[model samples]
Target: MRRLTKFSSAVVGLTVLAAAGTAVAAADQGDDWPYAHHSAASYTLAAVGDIACEPDDAENAATPASLKCGSPTLGGMSAEFATAKQATAMHPDAVALLGDEQYQVGKLTDFEKSFEQAWGGLKMLERPAPGNHEYYPYAKKGDNEAGQNGAGYFGYFNGHDQAGTPETQGQAGDDTADKQGWYSYNLGNWHVISLNAECKSDAFEHDCSTTDSGLLGQETRWLSHDLAANRRQCTIAYWHQATFSATTASTATVPASAPGAGGAEGAATDAWWKLLYQHHATLILNGHEHAYARLRPMNPAGQYDPAHGIPEFIVGSGGEALDTLAGSPGNYDNPNVVTAQAGAFGVMKLTLRSHSYSWDYKPALPGPGFDSTALKYSDSGSGTCN
Candidate 1:
């Protein structure tokens, strides 16, 4: 196990003094901001997963039944559109897209048509992770998307320069300059990381925890090193699957298209959670379960502790479709879960401070205000970094 340093605390004290300089540097790195003029004292971020609409007819007529398709309501426009609208309304400095940005086999065509239509506006500000759908194999030969290797994902975010064909660019995750989705950046005094979690072949029990599979395993090694070298007081890690799941959704650890729906069985992410917890990571965000669930502070071992623990949030209600919230909040099988709710599509907004963070999550309903029917899944609170 590892521990955070005192020097990180010292740095947080002076974050405001250097916010102006850091913000300018971050923007120059090619990340987008709504406008040039904004406060440097604190930054707001919007994070959600299982986004965009699924691709139904985007495929050919002869596509095999093995490749699933569905008729989304209004082409999944209304649900995803609402979330994107809410995200932009908050005017976040950056939007952390946990994963599953595209659905029903993450084809580039689907991304352009369904995802791009709704959340494409946030592409300039999105820091994304690859989900199982992104790695799903092509339904047929010679299709536009490269079969299941996340070429489309990398191509969209990292750019298509000479680094490597834009599609295959960051799929390697070797910690090189071009490692694509698994990269880190600074937000004021906080250091945030986006990790890739798809491991093993697409038809077996996921080897998500095997840190020796070479390609995806290399990413975890890089994460360990990245944490050891960090000097920031606050840190947040985001990925597609939740390590500690909390609802009735499927959390199978198998290598299927929708493994670990609620994330209860997602031991693949546990390896990374160990590292994050050891370093006293402030927060962990994930998608996959199509509901919003917040867990009580707990250690990597799933034991609760207020003094030294990391809180996890499952904000998968980013659109697509809604999964059931299972039984209830405290009644769930997972002991750490405090709240879980569904039937609403929305985004979680975070106002990241120097050493603390305040989060406000609200999902939009059809007509007026937010969703408050079955459960008041919406939440607002503050927490300090460990």
Candidate 2:
């Protein structure tokens, strides 16, 4: 009998006890590493999205002023923050972001506000992917339409958090970073990939509109190589925007009604779906839909095609603006889905195991106190492509 010890710090409300099996990040590094084998073995991966936080100044200006500090409109941002603080206080391994890290449009100021508000407490185990709002156009020299949009995002994250490693952080522009905003690392037994959605159009032949090029190009090639290179039993990849979502049809939903919703889907459309399917990704986490929605093991077409169905979790409820919840769970066609509260603000917690994974969605609530009901919906399923 042997005892395993964890190497990475516990993040937010995650717990990683290496009392058994392999190293979690070994999926990328290898079995000989001194860590838990799979995240299933050491810890669980938890996520939240569309966590629209209100800057302290904005709090005073919210519509329904009573719930301003923590309200459905703000995706209960303040509440989720406290909940994450509590969860991490419970001693968890790591916390992840699904995207849409902020609201309105992404700018340096917006990111500063986001960090000050939503990202205030969980800096310990913070990892993220970019959502559409994070890509507000910034005019770069040569690339006008494709000017350096996510400058604010780049400035804030700079790829990975290097506070622990001086070598990785002190270098100029993340030259030490694996790639621009895409990289892989091993933790526990999981091989995790964080990609930038803004780069989805980097190599698209057509305008971003008519291409399935979200995580394509060099990123896709790298992802394929990364997956093939690793032999770990579990792999997880997350991005800010999803290639497939039934949340709102362009014509019917409020987003469509919003001023700039027309080119929204074109942002990261279907580019990553095929690659994910091809790589047999075990779990795909994403945000941007403002509500929480979990797709059954699915394929490129958004169908319940289970043969290689990768369980996709849309945990975009991270204290942001709540989109209209869809009327029903499986209805991807309805246009007027104001009742679709699945878009409430919150986060998802995943307990990964060697052979199975379980996920729970915790939504935001008014809080001078926390609610156990926040942990209302929970689901567990066996590994599919493993």
Candidate 3:
């Protein structure tokens, strides 16, 4: 496993260690020197979302088939476990859990039985954001069901006490009525923000307007403050749903007016995209679409802008069943989508540098019905900071 060199303040006076571990005199160091004491010149991050299937999913009980626990047919490995192994193989400095980490209402018992069995090992290194499944019950069918309201998400990521004190829930974000899981932190030289996109869920009473006088408004205000106070040259923000999408489960082609086209649920994030764009955020990672898509850099309006646009990547192909692409197999309907795939379960590996970043989507396992060759699907590229 590769390791990041830890340089002490004493060494800063004489020589600064570059990302490549070459010793350079402090006098020759550039202005981009990392200010954080523990900052690394470069680091790796493995990211994915829409992970473990519900432990009680009917597929688990099917003859010669199991989707929750490992199956003997697949060498005693579940899809989630296979992707977890793929992520662990990278030895990333941190894992950005995009969200929808546990399916079917995200109950605590389900997380422990399914998600934990595979992803628990990376819990300490995981930076999480909540998804609809974490907040709503029965996938938002009526909102009257017994929902965890992020209790399972917070309880698992923050600790066991579902109704614990603020400190216990700090890691996952405050799940109170006012603050709905939005926080920012510095990683290496980049500012990483995790925002909860379930603003319209039952937890928030379906009020996601900027003037919503509730969690939505509070979250937006906090995000604005966070962005204003950030000083990092490179920034990235993540949540569950995306402002741009390449697929919707019900239809092969998403209508322009649908929520999948940044309408309903995705529209709730318009303010967020605007703020990040204004702040020159470098990337936006999302995972509610149940497929993988690499969109070209674009403004908050969804217009392609190579110069000052924030690119978005939908990496929902973590472990759950894959969704269809926007159009025919080879042709994607969304013009902004540069590339997309639906049959491969994978993790996006990000190599973050002081002033730039690179991404490599590594397929771990094939989804149902896909042959072994599906594992060969790949998407990789490098980009400089905005």
Candidate 4:
């Protein structure tokens, strides 16, 4: 497991330096500032996923017109760039990327040409989770071709060295023999876990069974240990596909048996949900549905459990074309969904405190057929950890 590096430590160091400077300036004025010695009690985190269209997708004439590159533009910039701009403007202490950050095979070239050009500025501040796209090598969904084994995704994050093999560069543990990409870290007072959800990929020989021998099983075991060791008051986990979907459009296009058949991935994650529920996890964030939806807190059984349930936020509206919500406006197929919107690209800003957290969803650009009203669409709320 890769550990949190000097980047996060540098952020803390800078905060201390800033505080020292403020104290010196205050002392020169001969005024005792009560808040001088106290550092900020909360930190801001910006999150989003399902970002960046392939630069060559348009020329290749990909299906579902929305998949074409250079589309859903705003003010002469692509939607991905717009949302990146929005997140950058917030200057959050850290960025939690849910998944599907690079689309259509997630090759290194594609990431460099598309994702890097847009979201690269946040690289140092980002804690990323892998998506199906990062594992699969095919452009179309449900392809049986050999996958990238997370070579591109891990190479990009772990720092690609031309001389080293992908496994040596930490390619989601495909060839690492032991460690997978799942890891945990602390952000302020909150514990953050980034899990690998592409267990069904060919990289692991398609072993996602519930037993301890399967790849996902190993991940679950690690999660159990991680949670047991964690002492933070608030904890959050993020990955690619959600166990509870907020959009029906994803399942509408493919057969239920397909590799990434929307709900199928969700079903496969039941074990994860169960583990998190037992651990009293505060939140789950995911992407893959290409829309944004905030679900009410619920237990692993999908029943509303306000007292001990964990709420989930599906913030897939990073840049790719938005998916249709589960139902008509103001109504939803999933009763647990509190609010959802599909005609905008945006990011979720999370203010994490000691034992509580607040969220603000800001739409940075309009999707196809959406007017200026899309920019006005907003959702904000606060919740306490269990």
Candidate 5:
């Protein structure tokens, strides 16, 4: 494989704003590119989301007093380091960070002091999506109605990392990014999309498919055109929220409070999934559940299909904290949910080929709870392009 060259993605020779898959300002052109895939036809990718434990400082608006970094084993600072360490070791062609890269209130100080310390190492190689936390205001507890907004998030990636200048970040994908929080790039033979899932109306968050319009329909429309113009045989769409979830018997006990994974996010809206499925997207990755789940191939209507459906993965366990299983395994009789596990902090690496892809999940050193539990999660397999 050779280094990817980014011509105008919009029109054949146009600079920006093309259908979608073709308008990249710059492709990843990975650090290890050409060398990493020197003699291979595929590229490796490290993908995860809900990353970075709060710094317990100003970045964490709610915990203004807990400035000291907490234990390196659990909810404090363990997951962030572990996941980043694993992703770096793999030397992937690109890292797709689903969302929630920072915690609590996603302040600029948080990204620099906490997230930048870990995952920032892979920022250049990352194709990121904006999470609900990016649009959410800082909340002392319940809903975040007044907070830092996404200034820190946008700036850090755009080279303007500082407080008060939160909006400085501008576009969400990366530098040379667009302000709409969405963009596309090429990786080897695959076309990848980094989308912004936080749709808003009157300064409040809404579902991606909300009929309220406002800032909701932009990405959906862009994605539809992008898919229609994609020339690649395989494609992947990633964002902060999951379009489908794995449910277990004890799931009811698990809080349904995560708005990003629920009504305010993509899974509940189904608009993104509908578009991707219609275009024959190969995979959908998300990180809002704080766990690792891989479901069977399925269509937009929630039915199984061996050949033409999209396979979804909920890999929110990039650190921050671990969430328990959705419920007892028995509660979910749906055969669609192939593998699901909670309390494991790790990263998922994908080997992207011209016409297929394979995934390997490696868990980090045991997090908070080390013993008395059997590790049952094992996700690794390859699937063909749609």
Candidate 6:
């Protein structure tokens, strides 16, 4: 596995210092911080994938019905990223793991391995949303291990709740301090929300279709009440999985829009989106796609709706093997779709300016594995709905 070198650490440290300086420079220029400023500065948050310390060998196991990366065995494809050490080196203010941070099974031991690796370099900064794997019931018959998917995840992350701090950009209430794992925070001018996908699995057989599932019950109530109460200038929701994807790789893999009603799984999130729109949301970021994609502002139905659309981003390529794009490409086919890139691992960087923000998808360094070019996507000179 690739490890972080002292030199790289120094480089990142220097870059972070430089960014701080730039923020200062902008303040000196006019206090209209661009890119690195406090009021108008940008902070980075990355969404990553089905990270596994032990990848299952397909020859010996049946492939997961929904996961497309094939069976993950011990250690992932990237040797350099053996641990979350690489993520720490990048020095993002915060980091997000989409789901399947472990593998096909959700054992506490397996979670420890995956967590140790994923949180290696980023122990202090890692904030996660539980995936379906984490919620896999521990008592299922015939399953290798009867594990409650998120027990370990919540055990570790729930205690590190810092959502109320100014760094996260929210006023975490008593509920946040108590719930911990499923909380919201504010950093700079953004309200960041971390959700547990396992919440959607509270239904029978741990399916999204389950009404009254704990996942839906808790998050929906929280989201509804929270959105109704938030007064932030910009809201950014980050989670471990995607509620909607234009790709047709696996329907089972796609998250349901609604919690239990299930009219349109993705549509279930409309209430939250409407609340965000009412409060002026800026973006929604997620992982679990094992690839990178950006969607134009659109409604839950994937229809173009500039007046109410919220920009959605799937940045699941962080240090994992990228999944191939599954659907027809280009604007003609998916009008609400903007861009999709497969076959590369990357980090997404957003630079927030006084009037707008610019985002960049920095592919991994060119090698036999993934591409290494920096592709920039901007949503500047545009106004977010309020």
Best-fitting candidate, scored by lDDT? 3
TM-score quality measure for candidate 6: 0.66
lDDT of 3 at 196: 85
In candidate 4, position 266 carries an lDDT of 68
- lDDT score, residue 131, model 2? 67
Listed in order, each prediction's TM-score against the native is 0.79, 0.66, 0.82, 0.82, 0.80, 0.66
By lDDT, the candidates rank as 3, 4, 1, 5, 2, 6
Global fold similarity of model 2 (TM-score): 0.66
Instruction: Decide which is better by TM-score, 1 or 5.
Output: 5
lDDT string, candidate 4, 1-386, tens digits: 11111111002121322211211211221222221222367777889998888665533454444444754442223788899999987667667888887776677767777899889887756678888888866645433324666777877776666753453433132336455577776765688888887777876667766456877777788888889988877889888888777787665654322323455566667788888888889889989878888877777877777778788888999987788787754567677777788888999998888878888887898887888887777888777776
Cα RMSD (Å) per model? Answer: 7.4, 9.6, 8.9, 8.2, 7.6, 10.1
Tell me, by TM-score, which candidate is best: 4
Minimal lDDT window, size 10, model 1 = 4-13
Tell me how candidate 5 scores on lDDT. Answer: 0.64
lDDT (CA) for every model shown?
A: 0.66, 0.50, 0.72, 0.71, 0.64, 0.48
Name the lDDT of candidate 4.
0.71
Across 61-85, the per-residue lDDT of candidate 5 in tens digits comes to 4454332258444445666887888
Write the number of the candidate with greater TM-score, choosing between 5 and 6: 5
Please provide, for model 2 over 160-202, each residue's C-alpha lDDT reduced to its tens digit, 9 standing for 90 to 100. 3444222233111122223445566554466677765555333
Each model's number of backbone clashes?
Answer: 2, 43, 0, 0, 15, 33
The lDDT of model 6 is 0.48
Q: Stretches of candidate 5 above 4 Å error? A: 1-40, 58-74, 138-145, 161-171, 174-179, 200-213, 247-261, 330-335, 372-376
Our model 2 lands, by Cα RMSD against the true structure, at 9.6
1-386: candidate 6 lDDT, tens digit per residue: 11111111001111222111211222333332222223235565544655653334443144442232232322253522632444544446556566666654555444445446455555444556665566664323333544453554554443324431212221111223224246666555556676654443443233332135444555667776776776656667766556566444434433322221212334345545555555557777766666677776655555555666677777766543445565545531344456676654556655443334556554553213433342232221233323
